[model samples]
Target: MSDPQHSNGWRRFWHRGTWWKALLLVVGYWLVYQLIGLGTSALFHDVIDVADPLSSPASIFFGVALPILLSGLLLIVLAASLGWARGLFRRESLPGRRWMWLAVLLVLIPIVLRLIGTRWSAYAVATVLAILALGLCVGFAEELLTRGFVVNILRSGGYGERAVLVLSASYFAIMHAGNALQGQPLSTVLGTVVYTFGFGALMYLSLRVTGRLVWAILLHAATDPTTILATGGIDAHNAATAGTSGLIGVAGIFSFVYVAFALVAIFLVTNRTKVAPVAPATSD
Candidate 1:
């Protein structure tokens, strides 16, 4: 017979549930993010004489890419160390419906066009590429930490699909609150919060429909650059200088459109007749 003490200990380690694990991941990611930001600022203070570190390729490399790369690497190490590799890297099939693919196309095609159309100086082109790289890292790190880690934990802890969806989405939205410190207006920040919450819900649905974290990561990486490009290219620095009312107006309109599409996608995915949960692998 198995030892009860050993069994309980194992359960405690693996079954810590959504709340605490999610909290820990959020706090940990924030700390890593902040530390990277501070360290990058110190390292590039002279190179990046301006207030914004995102204006040039060198600053973008150190300030955005380096930290995000480190954080992503750390998450990989932790995922392997904690025996979460299966959950973090699990794969699933796309949904059966054609509309889902249509929704994805709607979101993706325009963004790709905008990215291709955006004009940049030869030097600025390098910075734009760096920003795209940064977005890719952000997508991978954030998705792994949230949808891959937190969602799986919650699901394994016996949470239902709805509960899992809501919790994961809320956690993602809350995590973006740190953007406020970047000089975004309160109203614009709140608009982004709502927009991200809705976007998170769509991503949750995407995870359910597509059954792979890679799709989510790709979509997320694509989405970030789309936002930057749509709002007037990287050099605009809208968040830093756009006045409160103007920012609010722009954010509100953007959020409204995206949120509407997000809702429609969520509804389509969730209400499908043959939808089923894609359980994470049980092997450690």
Candidate 2:
């Protein structure tokens, strides 16, 4: 016979429901991320010699990579503890052909354009490796937390797919506000948030079409290093204050492209028709 104590524990757990679980997950991840950031700043303040934390390679490694790695691991552990690990990697069936192509275009076009127009530099091999590692960690942590965990939990909580997509994207975009604390100009930070909102939407559509996180993660990983290399590394102060007019112009153009693509993706995903069940054969 089942123990009454075990039964009571199970019942209490279910009583929390998906809404509470999602809220807890979001808040918990945010707190963990902030704590790591604070702790790292305290530990590394005297050790690192960089003037700006955002642009420094060592600072990026410690500030961005360490926190992201720890928070991401914690998120995964929490998800597993809550019995949601099995579905974390599950992919939906292939989306319609047109939507599939659109998804591909969404992921590829920006990356290709950025790669082509941006100039490559001759940074030391070690620096390049470190930047790549930073990119990988950012992609993995952000995607897992926002797209993987948050999206799945919301869906399970009876939220519509469209709502889930928008929510996840918005959250991803807003999280960039932390960049402001790193010394990026207010205008630059705002522009980035807008661009990222659109990027986040595209990532959502990519997951829907591919039914997996690998493509999303790869695209994300590629995007960061490409931007940094192309733009000549992360210079928050210069990007914000120096050549302000030119920066605004470039940001405007990029923002327009991102918003346009994001709208198209949203339309396609929302309007997609469900496959109808086939009628059974009738023997006369």
Candidate 3:
């Protein structure tokens, strides 16, 4: 059982990644996801409520779950085609530290805050289950796309650790700007962009510190449902209005910390220890 990334199959044709390909894939993923959402919404519009997608099972299923799941399936297919399906799961893609525990803790704290604020008793079990399924899909899909593939691609392209950190997180965060096209208010859209940028860095840290992509996926998965359920809406538009109490008041604190961590981490991300992996050569 050798590393499949080095296999003679896909590697022969795939060659290697460039920085532009990373951007292209990110844009392509956004397009596919948005198209899927549009397609599903049109197909299920009569059955699914157009209002409050987070709280409604049918809406969440037809809108968020089905669209993202389909898009995620496409990503998986692409990963397999690129010979990355198996290699993407391997650990220690970047260096780690004990201090990174703070990074992990900051990331986890918001989930706790949101959990306390969730009125779990208010929603039907089906709705709650739908939200969970949505989270799982989101976690796997987003993490696999950004941290899994993009990070590897950046490294393979000979980018330094800092550039990889910045680009991957930026690609993950900036894609949220699409909310504006979806008709979100300027304030809400800006807020989401800011929040997701920080969230993206924290997710990157989650991958780095744990040296495993799974932790990033799980944290992202946990964060989405909790935020959705607690806020009674997605993407913090309702964050200010939805949910109350002590810890929830402390919400968005992690965003500041994550951004700060990213800022400071840039200076520290100078470790050039990883040997950039090239496309495996074939014998003539």
Give the winner by TM-score: 3
Task: Specify the poorest-scoring 10-residue window by lDDT in model 2.
Answer: 275-284
- Write the number of the candidate with greater TM-score, choosing between 2 and 3: 3
Please write out the lDDT profile of model 1 over residues 1-284, one tens digit for every residue: 44332454544564556567776777778788889878877887766634566667787678667787788888887666555665466664324355555545555655655555443332356866877887898889888877777776676566665666677877888888777887778886786678787777767767666768888888888877655644443324454322333433444354466567666654454432222223322434
Candidate 1 clashes between residue pairs 3 or more apart in a chain or in different chains: 92-211
Which order, best to worst by TM-score? Answer: 3, 1, 2
- Badly placed stretches (over 4 Å) of model 1 are 1-11, 93-99, 121-123, 230-254, 261-284
Cα lDDT listed for each candidate? 0.65, 0.64, 0.77
- Candidate 1 residue-pair clash tally: 1
The 10-residue segment with the lowest total lDDT in model 3: 275-284
- Pairwise lDDT winner, candidates 1 and 2: 1
lDDT of 3 by residue, 160-208 (tens): 7778878888888777888899888988888777777777877777788
Q: After superposition, how far is residue 143 of candidate 1 from its true place, in Å?
A: 1.2
Cα-based lDDT at residue 249, candidate 1: 45
RMSD of each: 5.2, 7.5, 3.4
* Candidate with the greatest lDDT versus the true structure: 3
The residue pairs in collision within model 3 are none
